[model samples]
Target: MNASPQFRVLRSRATETHNNLREEILAALESIIFESYHNSFTIRADLEVAFAAEVQSKFAVAAHSGTMSLFLALRACDIGPGDEVITVANSDISTTGAISQCGAIPVLCDVLANDYTINTDLVERSITDKTRAIMPVDMHGHPANVKALRPLADHYNLRIVEDAALAAGACDYGLPVGAFADVTVFSFSPFKPLGSSGNGAMLVTNDEEICDKLRLLVGYGHDPLRHGVKDGYQNYTAEGYNVPLDALEAAVLSVKLPYLKEWTAKRRAIVAALQDGLAGAPARLPSFRPESAPTFRSYMICVDRQFEIYQGLRAAGIEAAFSYAPPIYQYSVYAGAFPNSNELKVTDRLAKELVNLPITPEFSDSDVEYMIETTKDLLEKT
Candidate 1:
């Protein structure tokens, strides 16, 4: 009998993306280094324009990271101390941390068991007089039902600062994930769907006034029309931080940007295969509403043996893990911090059962099959 052939390692990492785009990245960098004599701001400005158009937004400002983008978004909305921002607990610390950093309270909200996004129905009850904004996260590239919450937000006069860190290519309500938001932020971290070489984010908004505020905050609080005309004197608009996106990352991202739609389609195809392959498996797969067209940052499933399956996948050279588990409120830093933590029943349950499977555009059919077979085997036995 012939021996069985060994398959390639099934892992999702930014290195794979960078490796695939290495030549393009290098060429982009070379052009920036030798061909152009402009400052970092010039390339960054170009990226901002291109990215804004890609997402169908009127204006965009690239920032150092998604965290910075969120902070800037809230700041642009004038969120401050004693204000409250309603958001989900089953997300990266960045979601709530941005609100907290702005001296605003992060009011915890439960997520839906199916899509693992905020439960819009519960949002109104959480609203209080102090609430200034609603920051809904598109968890695991699943679009939060922001459209449903739009009326509630409008009624309360609250700003919608969407945290779409992992949802770079996802869409909802017949538009991009950020279309319904006052300000939407997309992350370009190494592990994100639209992975860049390093950390970067873009804040997009239709409101020019909000765009102006975001630019003022990212650009050292300098209003070009108001200050620095005298050459020696520079006036500040608002106390802001210098957190603009790096020019090199912008250049790399620009090369990758045009391919986003194609890449997103690839991600969706892989997930469809996984869903079909795992239909009989013990794990409960994620489900989205009909209108939501989510791009896979990572495919998540709820399983009883979360750790066992996670460890098994790792031992078998498949990268699987629990992301955003333990809920943010359960973190040591947030212990006793959120009074409403106990109300996040669904979020609490998801933290225990959710397992993220590696999904990337670089994944071949064999990689997808191996992962599916390995996970099903693990689920069957464990």
Candidate 2:
């Protein structure tokens, strides 16, 4: 059997980029190791500046990870035990975990079949007296229907915390993803659209009060006046947690932030090529609207016999797998907890059919073509 061209070409280029990025990371480590900072404030300020420039927000807070970012944002908004947060079940488990950590109930909602984002009508219907917030995840670098969601939130007096972990450069109409929500959380994990060598995360908000509260919550609730404490006896104002991003990781993330726009363009180009090549294939390509621009963090498709296709791609030396199979609600931890867990029809269908293909910046035109051809062949032959 002849190996697919994607196996021979795509993997090599991705490995090359990985090696080069590792060297650049080492050089950054060497530089930061010698720099002297007067206090932790300096590092925080640098991150704030970098984030503010990228998201066009006045306030940004650095967190230990994307999960923590969501937790802090929820906490700052006063969402705690007994509160219900409406969100989709077709997202990474991190979002659900964060909600549970804050002692809030996660109300699982179904996603649209076309875009794979939370259904706005379902979200509106899920609201109740206990509903305090709605967390819409931007799945696969595409923004959810935040414009419609904003109005619904205002109607119900609910807070909107956008999980934009996959959407670094994603924009809807003319507005960026972060600009539409009350609070937006972004991830800097190794697999995100704009990732660091290690874990880091950011929270962006235009609300000063929320930003101030989040800062205090992440910094042990220490009053600014107690910056210089004597004899290790400092007064703590409120209960909080230690969730600060490492300075070294922040430095590396700052380096990659500048190239995000170019990288996003490349991903879109590749998705377009794949769509065109597989126009008549049996597999279903992602459905993106004309008004939105997705960063294409992962090129995903839904099809029958998804498991067979997954194994076929692997045998062909193409790394493909289910993105979020066995939806979050099906996990043992959330088995009977989430409300409406039994009614997630679309979510259940997607969990069984979604397959994520490699769509990194390193993939070439031939790599995309081979993916389309191989996928078609597998679907037909099976």
Candidate 3:
């Protein structure tokens, strides 16, 4: 017998918080059933409060999904058609989806060779009079050099709506990822670092005007009236999305919120070990920026013969995988809907070469060692 446990990437489960998530959810249901003051919406409000406090942001808008938050953020910044939003291609289609949703064009940029983040230099040059925003994804929980993008954005009179979907609780320059951008979005999908029971997301910002618009837009434009109401239930002032955070999900996330930092610390420790084990190997580890602290939602490596290695990992009962397989622009669904200048050489190469390693907080020491050894063994054979 091998006597080693399987190392699968992204086998996420519920947070093992001492508090009962079930009870919190039931309390929310009770509020709804009993018709308490402010109704069950209090649960959603509480969750937003906890998340905002955790990230140290003045305002937080509970959203249905990370993509919806992005959509809202784009509108909050007044980015619309005929406007261009610069972003990298090596991310989920949702990164570009937000831009398209706002009737704006997503100008794809390349990424860094070492770290796999947005190539700030290329992003700077891509800016033009039509450029409205820069949406940089903190890929693999690593904060893209966002601080560098801020100065560049200021110079160009552009806005920044960060894709922080994978970077919950991540920090850069002594602050969380959401702290630096004009509006930052996060996901609480079951698999991310800080997750909810079901799908949930948030948009955090310090700007009151953006905050007001986000709240209204998520609720079908109720706050700032732009039009009229339907029936007697839902209303809308401006044409907006019905992307509210459900009460049950909010309750579940609220219970799990307190333990996020501890969980993040555990994940960071595992990443440190992986870095040590893979030192001077054929593979390249995470390309973390200086003074930035990222929660390891997942670990990635740049290696050769990516598919062969992926097959080897799968054959060994490892659940290793890669992302975007098509790097957004190349996705069959988009199929030339977005424009690219072939400057994404790094992004294109990484899409084919990078692999995500199993390194969740759920992983055990044995799991970590097994993955390290398995990877080394596979590399040797390759």
Candidate 4:
């Protein structure tokens, strides 16, 4: 039998980018070997500057993982026990996990039927005295109703921590996703659009005070006390966690940052082709406003017989999938811990219908044609 189509989801082009930056990586490695690996004033520090600029933010704080970025963002927003943070139910577990880790209640909300982002209308009603913040994730590399949510958050005097993990190069209304929220978090997991060689994430913001708090929080609550110690003691100012990005990952991310826009464009091109080809197919594809652009992190579509199609695709050597079926509350672990919005009809419907297909930038014309024809063929047969 022929090999299955290597449909690697959230595929990272890190290998290609790293190969291009081979000499730089080696030089950075040698520098680390000789200088004993300084986390600050090195590749990691440079990355903070470069990445912050790429995201159009005034400050960027690197972290060990995206979850850490989200946790710190939530903490910076003063979300914790008794404080409710409204967010969508259909997303990577990381989204809600960050809220839960910070001791905040994640009030699950439904996603819009068209784009599968947070229902901005549900947000205002969900806000009570305890709702301290609203975390709108950039679902499927497309902007949520973040701008619409801004008014609600402002009216309620709540913070907004945007999760742009899958939207590294996406823009909303001409502004990068990172530039529009109180604090925006981007993940560099190997699968993300702007992934690192390994794992890394960034928290970007324009607010100096929040930046200061996050910077200090990542370093065991050290109060801006530089490399050495004052009076032979490092002051632990607040309860914090030690979560800084690795220098090596930073080095890799630095190399890939420049190509992010090009890569995102490629993903968009492929999505356009697929959408055009599958015009009348029996699946609901993602839709967005003209002002917003998505990286098409994954091509999410809704269809009946989703499981049957998913299994058939796998059997036919495709890596098609349904990213977050059943939403969060439906998961066995948190079945009873969280309540599904009383009217998550669309969320529940999508839980059974949505499927993610290969939309990588590296896809060749033939590769994409194969995906389109294969999907159309499968849909017709099913």
lDDT of 4 by residue, 1-382 (tens): 2223254332344566678779977777667667676643477778999988887799999998888889899888778887888888888788888888878888888888888888888888788888899899898888886888887888899999999888899998888896658999999987788887678999999998898889888878875535457788676767777888887777677767888999899999999999998889887887887888777888888888898888877766567767877788777767666652446888899989988786677777887788788888888884
Model 2 misplaced regions, further than 4 Å = 1-15, 18-27, 37-44, 223-233, 340-342
lDDT of every predicted structure (CA atoms): 0.87, 0.81, 0.81, 0.81
1-382 per-residue lDDT for model 3 (tens digits): 1113453433553544424456765676677667664664777888888889999999998999997888889999999988999998888888898898889999988889877888888887787789989999998888888888989888888889999999997899998887779999999887778887779899999999898889888987785334344565555557676898877677677767887898899989998988998887788776666788988877888889899888888777777877666688887778877664447888888888998776577678888888888888887784
The whole-model C-alpha lDDT of candidate 4 against the native structure comes to: 0.81
* TM-score, per-candidate, Cα-based: 0.94, 0.91, 0.90, 0.93
- lDDT (Cα, 0-100) at 239 in candidate 2: 86
lDDT of 1 at 17: 68
The 10 consecutive residues of candidate 3 with the worst lDDT sum are: 1-10
lDDT score at residue 261, model 1, on the 0-100 scale: 95
| Candidate 4 weakest lDDT stretch, 10 residues | 1-10
Query: Against the true structure, whose TM-score is highest?
Result: 1
Ten-residue stretch with the least lDDT total in model 1: 1-10
- Please name the candidate that would achieve the greatest lDDT relative to the true structure: 1
Q: Give the per-residue lDDT of model 1 (tens digit) for 1-382.
A: 1111232443344566667888988887887788875745577888988999988999999999998899999999999999999999888899889999999999998889999999999999999899889999999899999999899999999999999999999999889889999999999987788977789999999999999899889888986644655677778878778888988999889888999999899999999999999998998999989999998898999999888888888788776768898899878998887774328888988899988888878888898999889889999993
1 versus 4: better lDDT goes to: 1
List pairs with backbone clashes in candidate 4: none
Superior candidate under TM-score, 1 versus 3? 1
